[model samples]
Target chain A: MSFEPITGRYLTVSVEGAPRRIYVEEAGQGRPVLCLHTAGADTRQWRHLMNDAAVTASNRLIAFDMPWHGKSLPPEGFETQEYLLTTEAYIDTVLAVIDGMGLDKPVLAGCSMGGRIALQLAALHPEKFSGFIAIEASDFQPAWYDIDWFHRPDAHGGEMGAALVSANISPFAPEVERWNTLWMFMQSGPGVFRGDLSFYTKDDSLIARLGQIDTAQTPVHVIVGAYDLTCTPEDAERTARAIPGATLAVMDELGHFPMSEHPEGFRPFFLDALAKMPVATAQAA
Target chain B: MIETFTHIQSQLDASPHLLRLGRLFSETVLIEVDGDEYYLTFDKGRIVQVMQGPSRKTPWRFALRTDAAALSEFWQPRPAPGFHDVFGFVKIGRGRIDGDILCLVKNLRFFKEVLGLARSKQEQAA
Candidate 1:
């Protein structure tokens, strides 16, 4: 089936006790399915998913640009700031968006940093989401590598964004999709990418807390790309096994940013995972 | 032409990105550009030593060898085709990545950003 292009609007939400504008995009209608993007990326990552006729036919698909990302400007008085995305700030922003938009028991689906946050959302506020779909997420990701250079201010004019261009895409991905993925990287801010990794590799810890997540109350599904070196399939397997009744799927020929890097190739797996997620249990108070 | 050890060291010293990227990397990396070799030592996140010639006492985690031309192309403000990334060069056999594949993959972004600093220096020189 065919559908209209996804459209977006500015959302003014309270961040850090001050009102800040966020960009939220939407398509279709029914039970809301909130899509979150990877670190340093914007809502554009969900364009294909939002456009999928089957996805939007019965679900109101929505995505948003986090504060200081995409069309959403940095918070007030922080224009000149070198953004550092902390776990507290990231989770707070997501909660604010949900409350401000009045989304009732929406399903949460995210990849990478977003995937990590989806786990956090489900764990901390299980009553708020019906189910959680996490792609390329892991618990207790050790800081095995470094990215100090990417956040360096003096490194300006450097091709810091280019660093992510070819790093994660599967070598076998289609040429058009591969270049499109690179385009997204080239558009991200310099320090923002590094700042996002600060949390992805460091702060967002779920190992000790995974036990708190009850899959019976809020169903959870994990998807890992077979070619993802950063959040390997092994990592997702361990995470899935930790959470009771959490299902895991390993997608072949896909890498870190599966949602965007290979949307068409990724759609079937995403649909299958969605079909297996439990229905909404309850609504937020 | 790309600057030598001293200049690159100073660049790393000035970049917060480099400092963070090097934090967990406490190894000596041997970089060979067109057969000219350079050794970089990291402590914490600081580049402790950068010297010409080969490393003596320490075993390097990786030795990434590529010609001067490929390096130059990769550092262009907007590199086309084979110049966009190291993997691109590897695809065409213009670059060779040897040593720990795991280490290379994990820290790929850091290394790429480190190399990308060349564009800033080159632009400043222009």
Candidate 2:
């Protein structure tokens, strides 16, 4: 199906009593599907999703840049230096976007860091989302997963980003997609990636709270790339088994950034998940 | 400026992160800077030997060649685009990697992380 052109907007939202400007992009005209990006990445990851007929024609596809990411600048008086992403801050930003846009329990879909937060939001506030689609999301980061290499001053700018992109993405991914992903990685502001990794590899947690999710109210689906070394298919399966009624699917030959690495390549798996969503969930949204 | 063999050795030894990455491989790799060559002999991921001015007898499994300026730029605190990666350098004709594509592919991250130790040294000295 042909894709629709997406329109972008800058919304002013209040955070911690301070006004913050966030960039949100949208297409289509039905129920909203709030798309959250992976840490250090922006809404560009969801461009293909925003354009798809399955989403745009029948769903309100919305994606926003988190604070200090993409077009969303840091809040007033906030230091861009030593920037770090915190669970509370990230959740607050997503909440602000939802409230600012007046979205009602939109289908929350995210990859990696976005996936983890979607899971958290689903459990902590199941009523806030109609469905949770977690991609490359895991319950816990292995203890040995150390990001200290990024701490070195040298591990900034293009070099660090190159290392990260190489590690996260599979070598067999399409060359154009690989370069596109690398382009996005290079545009990241200094310390932004390292800061995001703080949450991805450190802070976020949902192991003890899986039971909080009421699947009847919020259906949770997970898809992990078989080639995703960071959050392997095994990790997704384990997490899926922990949450009652949660379903898991493994996307073959795909890596961590399935949606962005090759959006066309990732579409089938995503469409399959979309088809599995309960009919009532769409009606409810 | 030509980086002293001892300086590179010290830099690698000082970084715990680099050490962890290096420990993943046990191979002798040759690095040619300008016309000069140095052989880094690794024993189970540790830098066991640093032979200056080429190796006469040992057969290296992998070799990378680049000029001093490119190497220097790569070791900077924040390297620019072409200097940020080995393959990137090769792509731009500033560097080349040869011999054993398998070994290079298998331990690509290890090699990248370990070589990044040069920049960490500058960070430490600062």
Candidate 3:
């Protein structure tokens, strides 16, 4: 019988004084790499990375679905309250996961909203991480589309969400992978995508706090896709410039969801970015 | 313009699955290239009529406006980054969408796919 090398488990983590059963997945073994998914998405976005033998060869890749995402259910009494992911709450959840998993200085890698939080993590607690791979991230990204479209009753939230995101995937990406990425957005729970956007688009810009990120302690590598209009290469460039010694790479023939839209194409850029990180570089040495 | 839209209609009709995906979509949409206007009416997934207009009487739920040059570039087999998608066009200031955004977003996939038929036609012609 054929089987994949990945393993999945559930961990109880506290977010805002409430217990949340977070779904976590891991593969391979070595230097830990904590993967964070984009807004409205889950750990499934990292499936390709986790399954790849090359990436997993010397890295223990770990990914988890945020509360109210994927297999992770929201805390009890979720129906009564409107879900909103504030910066404080998001950071708390990540900290809980890192502590619960007992990861010592793991390389933090995230995409889009996940990437935005990576910057926050760097500024707030650079000592906790060895490096950061911020993909499709920027300090201040203005909301490009109406958030209401993702949840209004007049529209099919799933399809509308998927449709909006689908445009951001490169036309060159494999048809199957492109569809798979859209499928994830399509599966998002009602208001979940909207709630996530509350932080992504409406939250305070990191421009003011970016100077606090000490790259000497923890390296920051920003990667942006040329075709990602939402967080353009210019945005990433501006972000890199703000943080002293931070590096930026603009990947061609790619879009917003680089890793999910075309993993094979994204692997080289990802490896190159990872190689620049102190922890990964030391491991290679 | 009529011929081009006619070709789009035929191309859209050829794809059964695309029509099925739009089974719930039925609306009239306006398409403006440069200054010329065209009204496209859809009934449950099929484009039944394509009417060119300068007439103000034609009511449409939504409208997508762009220059002829921009629309042509958008129809290319592989357009540039900002010209790749409708939203991309809007984001980059190459296109403008107006009227009831709810109607446009509710049937977003269907509308996008329908408009994308022009690209397929362009590809075939090339």
Candidate 4:
């Protein structure tokens, strides 16, 4: 029987003084690389990256589903409250996971909401991470549509969520991967997408804090898909321009969920971006 | 143009996935290309009628309006970034959607696929 090289485990991390059981997956051996999924998504987005032998050869890739997402399961008594992710809450969780897993300044990589938080993490705790990869990320994204529509009783949350994100994928993407990306969103729990978007679309912009990022100590790499209208190439460009020594790559024929939408096409760009960060080698030493 | 609408209707009918996606979607959608109007009526996932209109009486649950050139661009097999999807069209100021947004969002995949059928028609014609 054939099997994947990846392994899954659970890590109990304390965030906000509450013990949360987080589902973590890992593959490969070398310099640790922590992968963060997009908003309303889980660690599955990193399946392609984790399974790629090229990436795994020199990296021990780690992916975890955030609390109330994927296999992580909401904290006890979650039914009574509306889920809203704040920057502080998100940061605390990442910090907890890193410390809990005992990663030695792993290279941090995230997409969309994950991407935004990477920037936040860089600004707040540059010393904790060796390098950063931000995909389809921006310091600030204006409200595109009413977030309420995502969880309305009249609308089918899963279908509507999938449809909303479907436009963000490039038409040139592989058919199976494209639908797979949408399938993840379709499986999202009701109101969970909106909850994540609360932090995503929050008016608090990270523009001012960007100056705090020291790319010399922690290399910052921003890669964006040309077809992502939601977080356009312009947004990524602006982000790259804000950080001194930050590198930017604009991938053609890709969209918001590059890693999942077409991993084969995304691999070269991701590898190239990872190559630019010598911090990985430095951390390994 | 009427022939094009008819072709889109036929193509949508032929798609079982689209039909399944729109199983409960029943509504009339207005497509206005540079002020020229075409009404598409969908019932239980099937495009039952296609009508060209400048008439005042035809009511639609939603309307998608764009210029002829923009619509043509959107119909390209691999459309440029902003012209690729209905929301992308709105984002880039190439298209406008008005009326019952809930109705449109509810069966968004269905309507999006319906509009996208024109791309295959264009491909075949080419």
Cα lDDT for residue A166, candidate 3:
79
lDDT of all the models against the reference? 0.77, 0.76, 0.88, 0.90
Give the i-RMS of model 3 in Å.
1.1
Answer with 1 or 3, whichever has the higher lDDT: 3
> Would you give me the overall lDDT of model 3?
0.88
lDDT string for model 3 (A1-285, tens) is: 978998999999888898999999999888889999998889888889899999888889999999999999998999998888898998999999999988888899999999999999999988778999999999987688888778877666878888888778888788899989988888999899999988899986587999999998889999999889889998999999999999999988899998899999899998898788775546446
User: What digit string (tens of lDDT, one per residue) describes model 1 on residues A241-273?
Assistant: 989889998887787788788898799988987
In candidate 3, list every pair of residues with a backbone clash.
none
- Counting clashing residue pairs in each candidate, in order, gives 13, 1, 0, 0
Question: Per-residue lDDT tens digits of candidate 3, residues B26-121?
Answer: 888999988899999888889999999886998899999988787788788877888888888898898999999877888888888888889977
Which regions of candidate 2 are displaced past 4 Å?
A: A1-4, A143-148, A278-282, B1-126
Error of 4 at B41 (Å): 1.5
Chain A of candidate 4 gets a TM-score of: 0.97
Clashing pairs in 2: B22-B45
Off by over 4 Å in 1: A1-3, A154-158, A279-285, B1-62, B65-126
What is candidate 2's lDDT per residue for A1-285, written digit by digit as tens? 954589999999987678889999999877677888886678898888887877677677899988888999887766635777777777888888899988877888888889988888888877767788999999877533234444455334434454555655654467787767767666877777778888877774688877677788788999998656568788899888888899999877677888888787789998877666654344665
For every model shown, what is its TM-score relative to the native structure? 0.70, 0.69, 0.97, 0.97
DockQ of 1: 0.08
lDDT of 1: 0.77
The CA root-mean-square deviation of candidate 3, after full C-alpha superposition on the true structure, stands at 1.7
Candidate 3: which stretches are off by over 4 Å?
A: A280-285
Better of 1 and 4 by TM-score: 4
